[model samples]
Each structure stands twice: as structure tokens, then as C-alpha cells.
Target: MAEADPMKGVVARLDELVAIRPRAGGGFAPGGKVRTHQLGGHRSGFRGRGMEFDEVRAYQPGDDIRTIDWRVTARTGRAHTKLFQEERERPVLVLADARAAMRFGTRGCFKSVLAAQAAAILSWVGIAGGDRVGGVVIGPAGVATFRPERSRRRILSFVKSIADATADAPRAGEPPLAAAIAHIRALARPGSLIFLVSDFFDLDDHAVREVERLALQSHVTNLFVFDPLEAALPGAGSFPVTDGRIVARLDVDRPAARAVYAQRFQARRDAVERMSRERGMTFLPLDTGQNPVDILHPERLGAKPSAAARSAR
Candidate 1:
């Protein structure tokens, strides 16, 4: 038999990373305690096409007669009725950042690799949950968009496309994160769920504001993927630094360099968290060491009560 492809192995491990719950008393858990709520199996929130009762309003021109609530008309004795229409399925767009900086990682794997795994796992969850999944892959080469589609096959294809895009890309200048956010705003419609995955190292305040603008129209999930080394530098002595085209030696122990590095990393993390909270977006900080499958699974994340557990309840 032919040996299994490593990519397939990586993808098959999706279940392991799905729904990884933050440890009890961990900083990531709410109130520093992991809630025991079960989640998974059955869908959460709105599902399928059906008119939901919004609110009764005065009759307006071009309003569908079928949507008019007769009981309201009888009670009020005025032209007022309930409006309803087919509810749109939530479209999930994964905005992946494949900039050059993400190409580096001192532990476990490259940030780019982790990003691909995260994107694949999330796509699987979205597809399995009966939602459409699509994404825009941005790199130095350019941007490519995969239209929202609901199918296991399509999701797999999307993952493969991402893998291909990052395989041979040169590591150089940073890509335009703000411009990509603008593209997402233009392409995605209202009520869409956008997963913005990036290390977010090169973004400016203006770029952050632009991202907030995109979040206004959709549910945004800011997934910050980072390597442990990014948070704390290793004790390695002075090392040579290269800008791809130029090389120079710098002391890692320099007080200014150490201070600047720590400050920059912390500031970026703080900004990302602040933006997420301000806009009501889900902030998922994933370390490269964590399993992607666990992160994608809702049950493991304590999102909702599982079906069996709910029945027991």
C-alpha cells in the first residue's frame, strides 16, 4: 500500500483539536474557571429557512400580504402585521494572513503551518455545522478568494489550496492586512461570520480601525496564532539578524532591544483583545502547541450542553 500523505495525516487529526477546552483556572477560561457546560452534536442558534416573527409594523407599500398577521389587524384595527421571510444561512469566511512574518517559528511548527491547520479545522466545523465556508488567502503573491460553499469536498479543496499557496512563497515584505479587510467588507454580505487569523505583527492603528469597520457588518472572530517564543525570547546570546537582503548582528540582551520587543508583542496582543471586546467579536488566542481540532470543537470549548447531556439535564 502506498504510504499515507502527511497532509492527509494532518487533516485527519482534526478531531483531536476540535473543541479543546481551556483548562480550569487557566487565564483563558472565563473568571479563571472552566465552565462545565456541554456543547456539540445539535446545531446552535438559528437553523434552516423559516420566517421568524420579528416585530409588527404599520403596513407599508410593497409589503407581502402573506406576512401580515391577521390577529394584529383584528386587535389594533389598523394596517399592522408581522413580517417574515426565509432566514439566510450564516456564511463563514476565513480571512487567512500568510505574510512573511508568519513564516517564522522557533517552536513546534511555523506560524504559517499552524494557520493552515487552524483554517482547515475551522472550515470543517463550519461545514459540519451546516454552514457555508469560504476564505481569502493573502500572501506576498496576492490574494485569492474561495467563494462560500457548504460541502465536505469543497472544504477539503479549500484546505489544499491554502497549503499550496504557502508552500513556495518567498518571505519578504509584509502584505496589506488593512486592504484585505476592506476586500472582505466588499465581498461578504451582512450577517456573515468572518474568522480573521493572523499574528497581526505589522498592523497600525489605522489598520485596526479598518478591521473594526469590517466587524460592524458581521460576526467577527479574531484568531491570534502565535508561537511561545514570540511571547518570551530565548536566552540565546547575541545573534545575527537578517532582513533577507541585509544581515547584521545584534545583542539579544540589550536592554533597549529586549524592552522594545516585549512591549511590541504585548501591545499587539492588547490591541487585538481590546478591538475584539469593543466590537463583540470572539477572541481566540491559540498557541502553536495546541491542537487545532480541539479549538474548533464546540463541546470541548464548553459552548453549549451536548445532546445526551442536555437530555439528562
Candidate 2:
């Protein structure tokens, strides 16, 4: 028998994703060292006085010197330390867009496939960390959502839904990724880790505002799934493309046509980046050609601890 091609099947297979586990747990280190992309450490729940500086108490045997309250120590004639604790257990929610734009890819898989693959990797990671897994798949057909759950059955169901939603092409009479982000706004809970996977072809002000609002309470990471061909033309040549309605010939050899075409994608990417930066959200660039698992794992990120927060983000 022959081994299966990673890209030939369901963006990503459940068995394949589950097979790749993190060396360490998906949580952060003992102290707090998160990557630049994350807000650092979980704060969903707390044990001691966190950041409010509630009060100072006599230093215990294992008290951290950095937290020593100088004024309180001197006045009390005894070393005292400030105390703060933060505890958290967050859910991972993946929002995938299978819109018409994501339906086209000039690589091993479609942008929708890439989106599903990325979502599956994150879902398995969340399961590894003991977090609930859930997702929303929005495509030409409409929006499909799954509530976060820690059960394997729930995670598998969500992945299947994503693949099914993206399996078909855009119909001529479909609406524009209807109520995609709006659905997320309604489903995502505070302190949850939200992954938005999409080509963002129709990101209007309304969509932007919904994401912005969701990020205010939940951690939102924008996973822009695009194809390299969308970023640049294949040298100087003529290519044929379609949006399910009209099949058009693109003559990249024409003057400035390639530049204009590439700029359109660049501009949208730029806007998403600017928004992400301003909000301290994580932005991961994934193309249909790359292996989504290697690029998205919590430990494999450019920085390990930093990558740790990507799942949390």
C-alpha cells in the first residue's frame, strides 16, 4: 500500500493531526515568557492577588524576592512580599472561511483546504492542552458552527463540517460569506482562543468591526490562508481563472497587470496586519503550498514559548 498524500485529502486528517503532539504541555513556562505575538500567560482565573496590589504579607520561605514590598517590609520590621496569581483554562475556537475566494488555489490544495488543515491542527493542539475545541465554517453555502467541547467526538465533528463546507465550489447566486463574523461574535466567549482562518476577500467595515469587538474580550488570532500565486504571478504568462460565474483569461504579461493584481492582495494583507498590530493579536501567514501542521504547532513556532501563546492567542 502507498502512504497518503498530506494535501490530497481533507485539508488535514484527524488521525494525522492527533499523531503530532507537543513535547511539553501547550501551557506556558513556570514564570511567564510568551512570544511577541501573544499577550503573555493565561489570566482567565486567579488564585492570589494578581495585579490589583491587594495587600502585602510577611514573606514566606519560598517568597520571590522580586515581589518584596520594601515599604511594608521596613515598617513591619519583617520581609514582606506582594502576591498575585492568575489561573486560566481557555477554549480554542476556529473560524474558517470557505468563501468563493478561498475556493481557488493554484497549488496542492485550495485555500479552503488550507483553512481546514490549519483548523484541525489547532483543534488537536487544544485537545492536547485539555481545552474545549469548537469552530465556525462560513462559505458560499452559509455559516456552520460547532460549540466548543473537550470530547474527541466534538473536535472530529467540527473538522468534518469544515471539510464538507469547503468541498464544494461557490454557487452563482450565493450571498457574500453571510453572517460569518457575526456568528463568531455570538459564539465566542471571553478569554477564549479564537482563530480566524480566511482569505478575507470581502472584509468590509462591518466584518472588521465584528472581529474588533470579539477581540476585545477574547484573544483573536488572524490566520490569513492564501496561495503564493495570489501574491505573485507565475512569471510572465497568461492564466485562466474564474469566480464560478465567468471564466476569464489573465494576461500577466500585460503592462503593470501583475503589479496591480499582487497589490490588491497585499493591501488586504496590510490592513489585516495593521489591525492585528494595533490590537496585539497574533497574525500567522499560511499558504496552500506549505504544511499547516509544521507552521502552526505550539512548539514549532519561530519561538517556542512565543508559539505557546499562538494557541492561547
Candidate 3:
């Protein structure tokens, strides 16, 4: 008999990551006001295509004479001009974190695995929507970057890098969260859609500033990946914990200890969520116990995993 793979959920596989491409269709496309001039499906904040009618208002000096609404102008005995919304393609960049801290998980899969799968889905969705796909994978081995390109080959290479990064062992001199974010910002062009997928164990003020810089020109979405155990200690008990080298026991039975543990995690999560909202970035929690596909595409995959479940300490 063959033995089961011990690192099943801890390490991601290229095949599994590639398989998520098909499921990336439908409700996976992000809706937003992009800042690009390229023609595409998503609507841009500026008007250009004039395909969809916005409204007819009083004609201004700079208004296009061809857009003058004759009917409305005749009715009110005044000139009126029509406005329309322009649609354009947005570049999608997934900043996937496969850091050492993301290697641990209590349910579903490791944070690294969840981040990788979600990254793959986002990349594919961007390709399907006619947007260029690119990203940066932050792992123990360091940062790997990919330039935005509207090609399946580029997405495959990106997914493969994610899988490789997740399976790599901890190496010295890995880039910090702030540095990684800065790199991602540099890679992303103005008006690109960026996905920051990580457990976010190192989102300090410096990292926050870097993200804010990125958000100034791009639409940023922070995907907070966490495990059930990280959110709260298990019910009253002494749980055994280890990191493959060091072993310890958690006394969750103690009320004070449990309270402190839960409070610390909640505080961190809250701070991240609050910062994202304040900066007008989308914040979505990705629990390891749930499917990334379902969370990313709730309308197609059904109701998302409950937040209440994670709250029950």
C-alpha cells in the first residue's frame, strides 16, 4: 500500500492550481471603475466609448455638438448634450504570499495553499475578462514577479511559480511585507486591479503605507487568509501544538489565556479590515476551512462560509 502525502494541503501542486482556470469564469470578474484608456468590458470612470447612455443635460461650451439631444433641446427650447460611460480593460495583479507563517493551518488547507488557489482564480478571471494578468509570489525563497500579459502561457507560468513557492522550504533573507508590497506597487500600472492574498502576519505601518501608495493609482483588494485555530483557541482543552521542530501545549481551558488569545487575533483582523475600508479598498476574509472559489465567487458557488462560525471561540 502507498502512504498518504504528509504535505497534502501544506504544499500546492501545479496541476491542482491549473485546474482552477475553468472555474474562474462567470461571477469571478471584478466590477469597478478602472483608470485605463484601453477598450474592454469593465466601465471606466472617464467617458470615451459612448456605448451606454448616461444622461442628457444642458449643453456646455466644451460639450460635443454631435451629442446634442435634439428632442430634449426642442422640448425645453434649450440645448442639451448626452453623456455616456466608457468601458475598458483593467490589468489584474495578484500579490500572493507563500511565506513561512502561511504554512500552518488547522482546517481545510494551509494559508499558502488557499492564497495560491485564490491567486490562480483571480488570474484566470482577468484573462477571461480580456485583462492582462500578472503577479508577485512572496515565499521563503524570496519574491518572484510576473509582468501583466493577456496570454494563457503567462498565467500558467504564474500559477506554476505559486505552486513552487508554496512547496519551498524556509530560506534566509526573505523580503519583508513592506518590501513585497512596494515591489507589487511598482509592477502594477495606474488603474490596475490588485489582489493582496496573504495571512498578513507582518502588515505593520510601513506595509500599510505601501498598500496605500498602490491604492492611489490602482484598485486594491485585501484578502485576509486565516485558519480557524488562529481566530480562536479550541473549546476548553489542552491542545498539542508543534512547528515540526518545537513542540508545545496550549492550555485553552484557562479563561484568561483563551480570552487574550482570541482578543489579540480579533484586534489584528479588525485593524486590517479598518485600514482597508478607510482607504476605500475591498476587504474579504478567506478562512482556510472554506473553499477559496466559493468565497471569491459567492453568487456562482452559493452562500459564502459564515463569519459567525469563526466567531465561536
Task: Estimate every model's Cα lDDT from 0 to 1.
Answer: 0.62, 0.67, 0.76
Model 3, 1-313: lDDT tens digits are 9998887888999998888765423422333322123234656433322589877778865456898999999999999888776555667888999999898888878999999998888887677767888989999988898989988888899999999999899877878888889888888765577889987888899998898787655667788888988888888988788876899997778888888998989998887788777766766788888887754554433322223212110
Listed in order, each prediction's TM-score against the native is: 0.66, 0.72, 0.78
**Strongest candidate by lDDT:** 3
- Which sequence of candidate numbers ranks them by lDDT, best first? 3, 2, 1
lDDT of 1 by residue, 45-121 (tens): 22112456546677754455676778888888988756433345567788777667777665556677778777766
How close to the true structure is residue 193 of candidate 2, measured as C-alpha lDDT?
Answer: 73
* Candidate 1 wrong stretches, greater than 4 Å: 1-87, 171-174, 239-250, 297-313
User: Judged by lDDT relative to the true structure, which candidate is superior, 1 or 3?
Assistant: 3
The CA root-mean-square deviation of candidate 2, after full C-alpha superposition on the true structure, stands at 8.9
RMSD of each: 9.5, 8.9, 8.5
**Candidate 3 has which clashing residue pairs, if any?**
none
- Model 1 — which ten-residue stretch has the worst lDDT? 25-34
